[model samples]
Target chain A: MKTIEEINQKIKDGNAVVVTAAEMTRIVRETGAKEAAKEVDVVTTGTFGAMCSSGAFLNFGHSDPPIKMAHTYINGVEAYSGLAAVDAYLGATQPHRDPKIGIKYGGAHLLEDLVRGKEVELVAEAYGTDCYPLQNIHTHFKLEDLNQAIMINPRNSYQNYAAATNSSEETLYTYLGTLLPKMGNVTYSSAGELSPLLNDPYFKTMGLGTRIFLCGAQGYILGEGTQHNTEVERENGVPVGSAGTLMLKGDLKKMDPEYLRGATMPEYGPTLYVGAGVPIPILNEEIAQHTGISDQDIGCRIMDYGVPRRSRPAILETNYHQLRSGSVEIDGTKIQTSPMSSYRKALQVAEELKNWIEKGEFFLTRPVELIPSHGQTVKPLQIKRPSILVKDLKTKAIITATAQDNLSDVARLMVDNNINHLPVIDKEGKLMGIVTSWDIAQAVAKEVQELTHIMTKKVIVAMEDEPVEVIARRIDKYEISGVPIVDRDNLVKGMITAEDLSRLVCSRDDKRGESL
Target chain B: MKAWLNFSPEIVNKAVISNLMKNFDVSFNIMNANITPKGGKMLIEISGEEAQEGINYLENQGVHLTPVKRVVKKDNDKCVDCGACLSLCPVEAITIDEEWKVELDDQKCIGCGFCTSSCPTKAIKLAD
Candidate 1:
């Protein structure tokens, strides 16, 4: 047994032994974990992958005359300027105002350009105030111009992630990369055995104030990331899927452009690629054993991306060994497998951290407070609303005609009323049939004059009290544009078309700006 | 020489590839292919002394040929060796070398252009 201080002491005396997670695996295999722990003082792990929940907070120095900016944009991408003047948070996924360039260039790209020392345009708008008279300001600046630019990522370094595949007949463009149709390929995003969270599954060495390698700069773990959950199935002391996440923060000005990247997923959106590393001090034999976990022992679940839903179906479970082998079997068929995360970069990060430790340039800091390991799980969003029914929709008043009416008369009525569908009703106002403008065209071509000859008797109808979702599905299934609502006695009431349902959605969106 | 062969729907079911192999002394490797009953295209690399003769035979078979001078081109200066394009390559043409750098084999690339869109740095592009 040993302490972190003892390990630091050994490092000061130039006697501490440090190795990467990959090398540690071989050492633990050759000798046992107990013996390896007594020899090695630290094991460094790393990962580089797209972390969408990432952004940076920048305090652009106050302009001359001073402006309390309410709106801020960096290189056309808008940043949240809800804080004090000259301060804004630029999210990695935030798109540009112009949709044409938004997909290719996003906040992530701007962040990278800033770190690369490229000139960026800054535009701000503010309402005139007595304290700050300036209303508008347009200027250009670089990373050094900012008073403070800190990357406070909400989530980074997922413990483990699921592999994505498509089962449908069409290709799916997703954050998991392009999923080929019919499970043509599988893409998994994680450093697997080399990932930082995987090496310290229980979070014994990682928590608040824990020093880490963030985008080639020294940073610290803030707290638990959003959607972090420790209540998950585990095998060999490691979670099968994503279980733990860390919120990390670091000085953006000190970051290297090589480790900070901006990426665009086709048909999805822009995201940031973060390179992070965590060095685990082998204080005991148990810590040594955790770092020795190999790719064969780690399992990742396969998810079907074809299902466009929150909960996609689980295809199967496989290990990193099979994934790295280039293919895995899914339902008796061999499917090619790829990785969204960069294993090559992950190895580079681990080696860099290992070198930093061996050179005595980097030291481990005891966490100020440990992140909560229990009593944490994501809660599904609760939506409070009553189900909408067909009757609730603003349907058009029933337009009726008689089967005895001449075809020219029905055509004239349709042209005058600007209606396409007309319900043929009996003298008692009960619906008998339906006719569309297309029917009139066919009638004219056939030289038919009687409305009865052109009318469709087998009419698909809807009930007033039926749920709007049910009616929408029926309309899609029957390949119809509109349906007439009827009473129990088959009396025509009103008509609901695809347009009415769509209008309802638009109005609902206007009512709730950001709610789903 | 690497070339693309487009088979029309009328001759897609014919054994043109098999007859080309039997009649010519050239060897061929199929890098990528998307052929259906309706019609499709195939990218193949052909070599040997009779490679020119094989080209003539495919042209006579009513197959449209588009010589693949280049498929996807990579700018080494902009690439970060992050391996983002490694997994998306169906032909395994992109690989990480011992030094952890991404290596692209132009001869093996099928020119599907999947990696061009996924690259974070936009370092890869489809050849004009």
Candidate 2:
């Protein structure tokens, strides 16, 4: 058995053979694991995806006599300044709830700007003390100004991720990327076959203290990522869901901006696209076998993002082989599933990592503390309905007409409320039909007798529990003035008009504004 | 050989492109165009020996000529390749490859920047 010292010597002497996890797969397939392991000294694996739970800690040098910064804003984005006098943690998804810069820039962009050697406006407010009486400071900081800038991410790489599709009529803006309306398309974001955790399926190479390539810089594994759930169904010894994540730490100063990007998904907020690559030393034939796993063996379920729940329902179980083929079948409909993570970039990361190990610039580290192989699950962010629902948006004190009511009376009611449409209902408040001013005017011109004769019989209704956007699309698609909000039994609850939606726009802006 | 021109509604009925080809003895290849009722823009490659004269003739016909530069820029970070901008491209500048990722041909894209608004993620934008 060759020791790590022997591997180091071989690498130093330019004798060590390094292959990418992707290449090792083919090598192991062509020439059995025993031969592959003996020939290949290391296999590099990489992944690039949105890791929301990532952030960096910066220790800005003592500003003359610095006061303890209680709050901080880096380029108008709030950072966790609760650490010390000058140290702060800028979250990857911070100021996520708001504080938008030019429509969509946030903490991720601020971090990336810093990495690109751009000047960042730093503002801080602190309670005055005798030792350090300065309560506020407005300054500009470059990367060089920071004493130590460390990227200590709680989660970096996901083993696998769910592919997403929309079954609903409207488009879904999700972290999974935008899902097209009515199963128009599906989008998946995991690196899949090129992913780091996929190469080390059972955490054989990925564990605490494992040396890695973090955004083109040397980094190390810290611990289990926030929701590192290893307990998942295995198809060919590879977990089929988001499992076995890692907590990583690296010096942000040494990182490259090309591999580290900031992404903005509407409604979902800002996220960092962390490029991570891990080099796994081939200790045995088993290590080579694990790295050799194929794309067909790596499976991820295509989930429906249309469902309004924490755990979205999976529509189809698929593998990278089929997913990369560019389409998947959901409900017998041929839906095109596209990847969010750039495989072109992921491959480049792996190649660069392979070169690092070959040149003895990077080495492997045995785990100081390994993450549990099982017993973890993601506690989804409770989808709190702080915004208005369709029921809440309705004019509860609704005016209505019956089928027997004359067209003149219904038209008069519309003029009285300055409304365009009147909901026609039964005695039990169940919606029958809707009569607009146009319908009444046409009835008068045609000399029609009753409201049922001229009134539109086909009632297009909005559910009480549905979101406002869903109903808004209905109004736009049909060019209708308003829609009657109803319960499951066709019971007319209230009416939602374009005027109601306009009011929501003002209210949404109020809620989105940052607290002074 | 390359000319970028803008067409306002008043001058759109002038048939300046056809007039230039007939009068100046130049053939033109339309690389991109966003012709509509309100206003329009086009990027065309003028050919034949009299290409420069055709460009001058078209400009004299009240067509505003602009310089050829990057009119559309894609923020690769935000683009999910959902293909929302595919059908919106009047010049057929945006295409989905075998892997279903959206590829934008800047050469064929007119300065109209249709994909900017059509992009669900707002990944594509008109260069300032």
Candidate 3:
């Protein structure tokens, strides 16, 4: 077995392409084109590339490449290809290092720097189509190694996209690396612990800095407006290896690098490196029918080698340089200054652009709508009546009452069912008013003080058919703690409150505790 | 050497005397001060001591010395549980509960209203 250094030497020798899955596909296609023209020297890098190349040859009415791609199965489950095989090979070759090890994450470019510096060897690139697979690969490899590891901006892909407006390459590099100078070695159990760590007073007191790695990926997956595939089996089967990587990285970053390196390996494993695949271009005819980009531009960009040589080189060089050494300034203060910085400044600039768009600086472009799950449009929560529904979990009896209910009656209901508020419903089962202890107190005070004379007759009531926002707005407008849901016939249905809104807004899972 | 002794009615007196050899701005003398075998208060007149300092010194020494009387002040009545003054408190004397209730950690609380303005409730105030 060749050592990692040998592999790196082989790559530098131009014996290996070191292409990702996507690039491999393109290579395969090019090879197929060459083969059709009776050229046999062309070879594809990986399996996908070989397949694409073969397909391209068929399209070109030529023979396919002669080479067959190698494949392997990992842990008797996942199909390992390309760099995955290399990762496995390297992992198996290395002597299992001490389980307890400390890891320090620098910028995304840190590993690249290491590789460039010959401190570490790049044996292979794991093939992955998305960040999820890449993260999974990382975890798998880490688990196999059981050594102290550092994840440097594993979420940089998405972070790059999200912060493209405000982030510049330099700003990103500096932001990521500079955080280390300010942070003390800390350890956490899970990714969930990272947010609190960032908010810790010690960070403020000491002017410490922190950056999220895989943990940010977990946050993205768990954040709102996430689109998931409708295929239940696929959705459920998708491994949360990324989440685990995040948790592991969080735990590692919190610890002192040395101590963390020496700490026991987590029972769960390491992640393998997964290479992101390149996107295939749609056929020109198809593109002309669907996309707004001109066919000439697309053809020139993809097919015309001559055109690219003239115009593309400059753009590519500039982009490469920017990717290598861009900087971002905020409020006249230079925040980031590093080479290989993720496009953090781009993200910031995007944000500024979004703000300008909102201010109608020009006709704003709308983001493409995501395909809905199962082709179903999600319906907004609608209020049917003005009443809060409080039900007894055991008895399943709906406790109905109004905001005007007697204090004694309300108290009795609360004591009996062990509930806080009751939904007041009218005779037609329509929502009317919500009665709580506070409401009772206000009503009683008004009665005693004869303040009814000055009270407004307009009782801003919410209809059951209205949206939940109606009730929310009412609560905000009136400064009332709760709102009564009433039906068209003036009958109360249920009551909702600020607490309910908070719970609804903050709930991690959509399913409420109906059983409870 | 013989110790020189002088008598005066005033317990603390300041004298400015110029000598041909040296001149001094002021000098304090303690005369007719109480001296008991059980250790009566020995008034060592300090020319630089402020009036409040003398009173405080006498109080610390367990001497029943009284200075000019002043009006008594009222204690702060409103102490809402807002821990705005906590950070400013040199002693780390205040804490806020999960319910947003403020409480003074007596061991840490120095009774300085460092948190007073921060308190939305205006709960911290100086007392007489």
Can you list each candidate's DockQ?
A: 0.32, 0.15, 0.02
Q: lDDT score, residue A79, model 2?
A: 87
Q: On a 0 to 100 scale, what is the lDDT of residue A225 in model 1?
A: 89
Best by lDDT: 1
RMSD of 2: 6.9
The numbered model that scores best in DockQ is 1
Give lDDT tens digits, candidate 3, residues A1-516: 222244334334544223222222243345543232231111111000000000000000111211111232222222223332222221211112322421111111122222222232221123333322331222122221323233321221210110111121111111111111211110111111001111110111111121111211111111112222222221112211111111112222222211111101112122122111111111222211121111011110011111111121211111112222222333343222221111222222223322322333312111123122243222445545333323211122457754344556666787787666566554567654455555556767666332222223345565554545546655796787765555657665455567766775455244444425
* All candidates: TM-score of chain A: 0.80, 0.81, 0.23
**Candidate 2: CAPRI quality band:** incorrect
Arrange candidates by lDDT, highest first: which order? 1, 2, 3
lDDT of each: 0.87, 0.79, 0.27
Residue pairs with clashing backbones, model 2: none
iRMSD of all candidate structures: 2.4, 4.9, 22.3
TM values, all candidates: 0.77, 0.76, 0.21
How big is the positional error of residue A375 in model 2, measured in Å on the Cα after superposition?
A: 1.5
lDDT of 2 by residue, B17-73 (tens): 777867887777877688887888888777788877777787788898876666688
Q: Write the per-residue lDDT of candidate 1 for residues A1-516, one digit (tens) a residue.
A: 888899888878878899999899889988999999998999999998889999999999877799999999999999999999889999999988898897789998898999999999999999979988999999999999999999999999999988899987667789888888899889898888899988989988889988889999999999888889999999989999888999999999999987888888777888898999999999999999999999999998999987655677899989997887668998898877767777878888899998888888888889988877888897877547655877787776668899788888889999998888899999999998999999999999989888888888988888777777767877897898888898779899988888888888788888798664
User: What RMSD, rounded to one decimal, does every model reach?
Assistant: 8.3, 6.9, 25.7
